[model samples]
Target: MWKLNPRALKYLNEVARFGSLRKVAAHLNVDVSAISRQLAQLEEELGTAVGMRSGQGFVLTQVGEELVALFRQQKASEAAALSRIEALQSLKRGRVSIAVGEGFIADLISAPLQAFMARYPGIQISVEMAGANEATRLVKEDRVDLALVYAPSPDAELYSHVVTRQPLELITPPGHPLTRLAPLSIRQISGYPLALIDQQFGMGQLVSLVEELEHIRFEPQLRTNSVAVLKNFVLSGMGVTFMPGLTVHSEIKQGRIACVPVPHPVLAGASAHIVSHKGRELTVSAEALINHLHDGMLFFN
Candidate 1:
């Protein structure tokens, strides 16, 4: 009988990832001593030192590294088997997990989710709101079956399908002075106190364009990750912001906000993308949803 159990392997993997047995224990909600004992048992079963303390950190041995690779393969095989068993029932009955940016949640995902739920009420759908970077990471790590993100620069490990292209518009409170202009240049907008998204966000690329055109740095009166907050700030006469045209459409029509076209050097466009791990096979439900999103993009166009 194999002395090392799957639980021990899981502990080893966790320790390797977290770098501390205490952290692994906390994450797994187990006692630190228990994790230590498990590691000792695993090392004894394999007849090798799996990990060693170095400079107040645990470092995995070569044997530990090899074992971790095998353990991950085993886990993946188990997951595939489970997925296959679930898929055998009904594709629509299985769960589909998607990680998406907050900006796309209300406009893009809400309608599709409503329609999908109406058709297949039994299908479980989990939507996690994450930033574009986190969305990419979640999809690549297989934590989520699919992700909706703004396409960043191309990367070899991801396969992206552009769902829709949204134009960026300068948004301000209704009847703001900028609304009177047919088109405004970056320099013209630089005079206002900007309410901008931070540099890590997808929309931050737009700020870079304005910076280059105006040859001056913007000191935002407010910086936020939430589009709703930025919209509210603009509406309340706090500051102006740049956002995708789709996001401000209702407000623009309602006269709560005004959107003006920005000129050439400061032009901004972003594409909504459905991304998946480059070579991984997507679950049936994930594939179905991807197809649905592709179909849905036609309506937006």
Candidate 2:
């Protein structure tokens, strides 16, 4: 069995994160030569070159990528162990990192996050807005403390809880012809050019639902990954879009955009979930944020 030194692993992890050994050494307040020596020792132990000098910086080799995975797994385990011990002490000031989708940011988390900040003034909060795939990737990579994503994974290594259930609705300009209809079906919506989120977005899941209910293929006049752009297009009367109810609530109330319930029952069942990596421990701030989220979710129900 190969023995891994924690210090060397730390050095490697920092190097990988910063993309420069000199920067890693500077952050750690160590000599650059010391970092170089540690990297050499690590490569010797692994019996392969983990990284190579590129101009003024270093780039990871394939072996380095594998080492990074191993190091991250070990680091996560150690962090979990420390967190358990710390939890027994008390929940105090700590940092929490979260990744979420843009739609959820506008609809669900923004207000609660602001309130959380006000309550836990000592706790540091970091948030990253990304697509569902990127959100999941961040959680899996241990880059984020928690992720709120649109889709759920069946993987046993991921723990998921439904934070909120948002019904999908078709939105158009307030006085659009479709607004007069009692309820609009997917087939009827397909008759017009649709503005949709690109396939990478969670909204792309609706495509299958649309296909199941309607025989006609959709021809999207505009496709964007940005929730803001999608809403702008819909509000401008350029084209109609299928979006979560929370996303356009204010617009609907203001009579700028009209939301019609999807006639297909299956389309209404889409939900957003809060997910975390399995076996990972939550920091003090992370746990508090999760509790706040649970409380906020009650409003959706």
Root-mean-square deviation of every model: 3.8, 4.5
lDDT of 2 by residue, 63-158 (tens): 988887788877776776665565665544567788978887765555777787777676688889889878887887789988887744356767
TM-score, prediction 1: 0.79
Stretches off by above 4 angstroms in model 1 are 1-5, 16-19, 37-81, 151-153, 209-215, 264-269, 297-301
Residue pair clashes in candidate 1: none
lDDT of each: 0.74, 0.77
In the range 1-301, model 1's lDDT, one tens digit per residue, is: 7656788888888887778898888898999999889889988887889999887678999988877766765654565566677678766476778887766766665477778777767668899988777778777556787887763546787787545666567888878888887667776777887888765556776676567766878778888888888888998988799887667666778888888877654354556678887766666667767887776643234
Error of 1 at 83 (Å): 3.7
Q: Which pairs clash (backbone N, Cα, C closer than 3 Å) in model 2? A: none
Report the number of backbone clashes for model 1. Answer: 0
- Candidate 2 — number of clashing residue pairs? 0
